[model samples]
Target: MTEQSAPGTDRLSSVATAARILREFGKHSTQLGVSQLARRVGVNKSTTHRIIWTLVDEGLLERVEETGLFRLTTTMRSLGASAETAQRLHEAATTPLDELRRYTAGTLHVAILDGTDVLYVERREGPGAIPVFRSVGSRNAAHATSTGKVLLAFLPAERQARLVEGMRLSPKTSRTITSRPEFLAELQRVRRQGYAENRGESEPGMCSVAAPIRDPLGQVVASVSVAEQVESVDAGLRHLVAPIVETAARISSGLGWNR
Candidate 1:
């Protein structure tokens, strides 16, 4: 009788094997041979060969034709670059965001556009911070927040359309923009004004103002937002716009946004 793995066991084992192979590659500063890699990971030569070939096929590793050695590929370099960019964005935004939080006595956030949501990368709160709920690494719907609006507003129209196409508009508050046409117009206004404002749209008592953080290419890569209670914001929206825009601009400058 032949032994059989419980359902999904083979797939899980393969995944573990692949992960081990990738980890072993990281331990080396140079290309690794199949036998050497197998010895390091304590896997059979054939299993190591299979995992290495799979990784190479997936662009995670590259094989040297002359030496038959395998090494990490440019894919890892791209991943590193992405991580560095996020880290730089967080580091660069910290001081300015803190100052803005202090100035406004509210919460400040630095967020990146992730698909149809906003990914909070950094956050600062002052003594007068309101009771809104969000944290670093939190994700919020892109249609319901100031940061999300600025990010979506700066996107190319076709791209924006694709993101909203056939998507159900979920309502978070009575003030949230639900219709596609109305939301599109809101994005238009946000693009023209170079900022976005949320007024009791995300949460009943909360408001936020946000401006885009641009890259050296003039592409919006992240956003800076100031969030406070609605009562605290209604009277000061106009005054708040200038400083928020300025803060985002300064952060963008730090990120190499010249224009």
Candidate 2:
């Protein structure tokens, strides 16, 4: 038996709900009330109430004191700065991605972390590239993708724990790491090795490797990945390591990461 505690399903469920509630704010210009947030996110009012208060406690939101509405705090504004970074990250990765595509003849992707998911911001298919059923705006669970694992492995420990624990780790394939301990261990390996790999974890027959892209502050902000369809999970992985790492380093340097 796994003895992992239903993998804390509700813990992550609530987290995902909180994320949805927060995103609803982006669609509006003013402060929002619990009822409106509930209606928009399709959650009951009471649950939305708790989630908002939790966000308030976390300092991402602030209560209006008199009107009982909630507004984003300065903390959120600081976090929102990443949106600009995302644009720059896209620009930074473009030339590197083009080079990687020509060099590897595989599908290349660049992604940014968004809550528990890795949002694909750019995708390119080289000659003989494998078809990965995702696009510029599509998203995938971080636990399942090489790009997502790279992002997760580089996150601050406390925030990483919160996110990894909250994730359900549902199996996407026979090799998916559905156990939290196992997944954490894998992340450790990824961090130590400075890259991450997917051996048909996200989809059968698809294998990928990714490396982290860091900003000027040396914080990892995105990942560059290349994937191919292979007969075995291990096929070509050894050769991919250096080239993918080189590609990521180039992209990171373009973003002003010195190391």
Best by TM-score: 1
| Prediction-by-prediction clash tally | 0, 0
Tens digits of lDDT, candidate 1, 201-223: 87877888899999999999899
C-alpha lDDT score of every prediction, in listed order: 0.84, 0.86
Q: Please give each candidate's TM-score.
A: 0.75, 0.70
For model 1, state the Cα shift of residue 46 in Å: 3.1
Model 1: lDDT of residue 32: 88
Query: What digit string (tens of lDDT, one per residue) describes model 2 on residues 1-259?
Result: 7757675564777888988888877775458999999998899999999999999999888988888898889778667776777788788888888877546777888898989999887788766655454578788889999999999999999999999989989999998899999999999999999999999998888888999998899899899888888788856366788988998999989999897
CA lDDT of 202 in candidate 1?
79
lDDT of 1 at 196: 94
